[model samples]
Target: MKEGPNIAAIAALIGDPARANMLQALMTGVALTASELAQEAGVTPQTSSFHLSRMADAGLVSLRKQGRHKYYSLADADVAALLEAMSGIAMRSGMTRVRTGPREPELRKARVCYNHLAGEYGVQAYDSLIAREFLVEEDEKLVLSSSGRSFFTDLGLVLPSNETKRRPLCKSCLDWSARRSHLAGITGTALLSFFFDQGWAKRVEGSRVIQFSKAGDSRFHEAFSLQN
Candidate 1:
């Protein structure tokens, strides 16, 4: 690599299967300890720490110490976005491994992508919002309309006054499983939190799945008019 940004370095780091697994696990937006990551990577704790150290040095992962244990998470939403994009390309290109996991179906139905909702329900919500004029696309960017503000407020989600201005109010993230766009950014994060607060869904332990109860699922579909 010359004196420029080197994607090859990042690619090489993520190319290892164990490291890839660790990164995928972090896509759930949960900080995991070295031992927990080792279990996900099918590696020993020492090896997990070694791999984690390299990724952290490369800005692929970030670590925080809680008590005596250090928990690791993706460095940022950009890293998670990159991995999600890669997964889409791999699936579209037929480069996927055979025999998806038992949880794969649930994941495809609904899951968390970093700090936002993803999969079928997420896609539906994004589409519905656009159709209802809650959001608009302009100049390759998602813009939350004035109606969107009212809609979200009615749902009991008020935009924080001190929310970081660096992040957009609305953004689109490509869903890996659905191969479609899902809402992201500050608004997306707020909506997902709203779902939890409304008791519409809960995160599955040790996984990325967001399981909605029967009534919750019905309410979700009705609220979003996703009965297509």
Candidate 2:
């Protein structure tokens, strides 16, 4: 057999189906309890615990102990990126291209990226800004324009408290499924928060999927011109 990229280590870590599911859940960035994750993977708590323990030992996940509950999340942002990339490859390799039943449209819409927005809506938002010349994309990095500053200012999202406000505004990250660059970095996070503040989106309780209410839907459609 021909050899592949030097990812035997990562391949092994993700090779376990149960561990893979746990990693997918953590990709959403919320710390999930063992039980919640167990349900997600359709495994018993003990099975999930075993998988989580293995992942935690591998440094793929971080474990936190509260007063009682133990919460698990991706070890860091890099871990999330790694998982996303792995998912992208899996999709391209025809690992999960088939869905026998109806797919959940909301999932491919606005969803959490660790702590920010991602998915089709995400791609559209970033694209609209680029189309309008409010944000410039160059070499996968975004530098906000004068109009961008004014845009956010009028939207009521002040610049974050950075010692040097010269930080790059937005960064383009490759979306695993969409095969396009979506927004990331400080600008991306702030804009997501702005959407929430402006009532353009709301988080579904106990879940990371964001659903746009009527006002929010209209606002998002008007602001970014996203196709349903």
Residue pairs that clash (backbone atoms under 3 angstroms), model 1 = none
Across 1-228, the per-residue lDDT of candidate 2 in tens digits comes to 868765677678788777887777776778999999998888999999988888888778899999999999998766776776776777788888467233346766777777667888888888887887888856745778888778778767786534233334566766777877778777777878888888788877655578888988787768776433
* lDDT tens digits, residue span 1-228, model 1: 369888889999999999999999999999999999999999999999999999999999999998998999999888988999999999999988788889999999999999999999999999999989899999987888888889888878897544454578888999999999999999989899989989999999989999998988988888788444
> Pick by lDDT: which candidate is best?
1
Each model's C-alpha lDDT?
A: 0.92, 0.76
- What's the TM for model 2? 0.82
For model 1 the local lDDT of residue 3 reads: 94
TM-score of each: 0.95, 0.82
Say which candidate scores most in TM-score. 1
Candidate 2 — number of clashing residue pairs?
0
